[model samples]
Target: MIELSREKLLLLYRQMLSIRLFEDRVYQLFLLGMVPSTLHQYQGQEAVAVGVCAVLNRDDFITSTHRPHGHAIAKGVPMKRIAAELFGKVTGCCRAKGGSMHIGDYSVGMLPAIAIVGSGIPIANGVALAFKLRKTKQVVVSFFGDGATNNGSFHEALNMGAIYNLPVIYVCENNFYGASTHISKVMKLENIADRASAYGIPGVVVDGMDVLEVYRVASEAVNRAREGEGPTLIECKTYRYSGHSRSDPANYRPKEEVEFWKSRDPIFQFKKKLLELDVLSEKEDNRIRSEVEKEIEEAINFAIESPLPSPEIALEDVYA
Candidate 1:
C-alpha cells in the first residue's frame, strides 16, 4: 500500500467520522419526523466512498446510488447543503427537489444520485464518453450495490465502456444484500469482481472495511483509467449497520451475521489503525470527533433555519 501523509490520513478519518455521525443524526431526526421522504442511511460503508474519492481530482465526476450521502460528503459537497436537501429546504443542492436519496452537488462533480438501481452506470458511461470525446483526462466513478450488478444496465454499460475504453470505474459496494435479499441467494459466484472478465476489463476485489486497502486498489484503477487503459470493476466487500431503509427493521438478517460485520466497522477499524501508526493520538482523535460533532450540529441548524421553496415557484425548473 502507498504511504499516506498525516494530513491525508486525518482527512480520511474526519470524512468517515463525519458520515457516521451525520447518518446517525439523520436517523434520529427521521425517527422524530423532522426529515421528510424516505431514507437510505450510509452507516457502515464509509470507507468505499472516502477511499475511492480520495484518489480523484475535483474535476473528476462520480455517479452515486440511492444511498449517496457518503458519496456527496466524500466528493466535497457541503454538509449544510446535504442536510438542507434532506430537510427539503430551498438551499439544498437540488433546490429541495431531490431529497435524501438524490443528494449531490454538480459543482463538486457528483451527479444528483439516480434512485433507480444500476441506472447511473449508463449515465456515468455517457459522462465518461463526453470526457473522452472532449479529450479530457477526467474519469467518472459509478457506485452501485450488489443488486445492480444483476440489472441489464450494468452489463450493457460495462460492455460499452470496455469497447470504447471509457474512463469509468464501476464500484460494486457489495453489502451482501439487495434490500433484504442476500447476494448468495441470487448469484453463485464467490466474488462480483469476477464478472469483469466477460467484458475484457480488469476486475479487483478489496476489503471495503479497510480504508487503506480500498485506497490502494482505487488508486490503481483511477490511474489506469486516466492513462486510457479503460474501465475496471471493483467489488468492495462491505456491509451496512442500518436497515435497508428508514422503515426496515432488518430482522431478516441473522443476529450473528450483523454482529460479525459490526465488529469490523470501517470507522472504528480506521481509527485504530491511525492510532497504531502513531498518526493519531487519543487526544487528537477526541478533538477530531468533537469538531465533527460541532460541524454536524451546525449543518442541522443551517438546514433548520433555511427556508422551504416557494409554492409559486414549484415549476420554475421543470422542463417537462
Candidate 2:
C-alpha cells in the first residue's frame, strides 16, 4: 500500500464522503420526483474513482461510464455545478442536458460521461492519441464496469492502445454484476484482469475497498504511462451497495453477499484506517462530516434555485 501523507489521506476521505453524500442525496431526490432521469449510484465504488484520480494531475483526462458522478467529483468537478447539472438547470455543467448519467466538465479534463457500456474505452484511447500527437505528457483514464469487458469496443480499444503504446489506463470496476446479471453467467474468467494479457499489456487487480492499495497500484501504472509506456488494465473488485438502478431493490443479489460487501464499505473502512493510524480523531472526523453535509446542502439549494434551461438553446450545444 502507498503511504499517504495526512493531507492527502484527508482529501481522499473528503472526496469519498462527498460522493457518498451526493449519491444518497440524489437517491432521495429521485424518490421525491425531483430528478427525472435514471441514476446509477456509485455508493460502494467510491475508492476506485478517488484512488485513481488521486494519482492524476489536473491536465490528465478521464472518460467515464454511465455511473459517472463519483468520477466527476473525484476528478475535481465542482459540487454545485454537478448538482445543478443533475437538476437540469441553466447553471449546470452541461446546462441540464447530460442529466444523471452523463455528468462531467471538460474544464476539469473530464469528458461528458458516456452512458453506453464500453463506449468510453475507445474514446479514452482517442484522447490519448491526441495527447501523444501533440507531444504532451498527459494521460487518460477510462472508467467502465465488468459488463463492458464483453463488448467488441473494449477489445478493439485495448488492441489499438497496446499497439501504439497509448498513455491510457483502463479501469474495470468489477462489481460482479452487469446490471442485474451476475458476471459468472456472462464470462467464465475468475478475474477480469486476465484479459489484459490478450492485448499484451500489464494487468493488475487490487482491493477496490482499500483506497491505499488502489492509490499504490494506480500511481505505478500512471507513472509508467507518463513515461510513454502502454496502457494498463486494472480490475478493481468491488460491489455496489444499491441496486442496478432506481426502483430496483437488487433482489437478485443474495442477502449474505450484500451484507458481506456492506461490511467492507470503502468509506467505513477508510475512516477506521485513519482513526487507527492516529491521522484522524472522532472530533475532527465529525467536523469534516458536518462541513461536507453543509456543502452538499448548499449544492442542493443552488440547484433548486437555478433556472431551467431555455428551449431556444436546446439544440445549440450539439456537435452535429
Clashes of each: 0, 0
- Across 1-320, the per-residue lDDT of candidate 2 in tens digits comes to 56778999999999999999989998999899897777889999999999999999999999998889999999999999999998899899988888878888999999999999999999999999998889799999999999999999999999999999999999999999999999999999999999999999999999999988899999999988989998999999999999988877999999999999999999999999999999999999999999999999999999999999888988897795
Worst 10-residue stretch by lDDT in candidate 2? Answer: 311-320
Q: Scored by Cα lDDT, where does model 1 land? A: 0.95
In model 1, where is the ten-residue run with the lowest total lDDT? Answer: 311-320
| Model 1 lDDT per residue over 1-320, tens place | 57999999999999999999999998999889999988998999999999999999999999998999999999999999999999999999999988988988999999999999999999999999999999899999999999999999999999999999999999999999999999999999999999999999999999999998999999999999999999999999999988899889999999999999999999999999899999999999999999999999999999999999997767887885
TM agreement with the true structure for every prediction = 0.99, 0.98
TM-score of 2: 0.98
Task: Tell me, by lDDT, which candidate is best.
Answer: 1
> What C-alpha lDDT values do all the predictions have?
0.95, 0.94
After superposition, which runs of candidate 2 have C-alpha atoms over 4 Å from their true positions? Answer: none
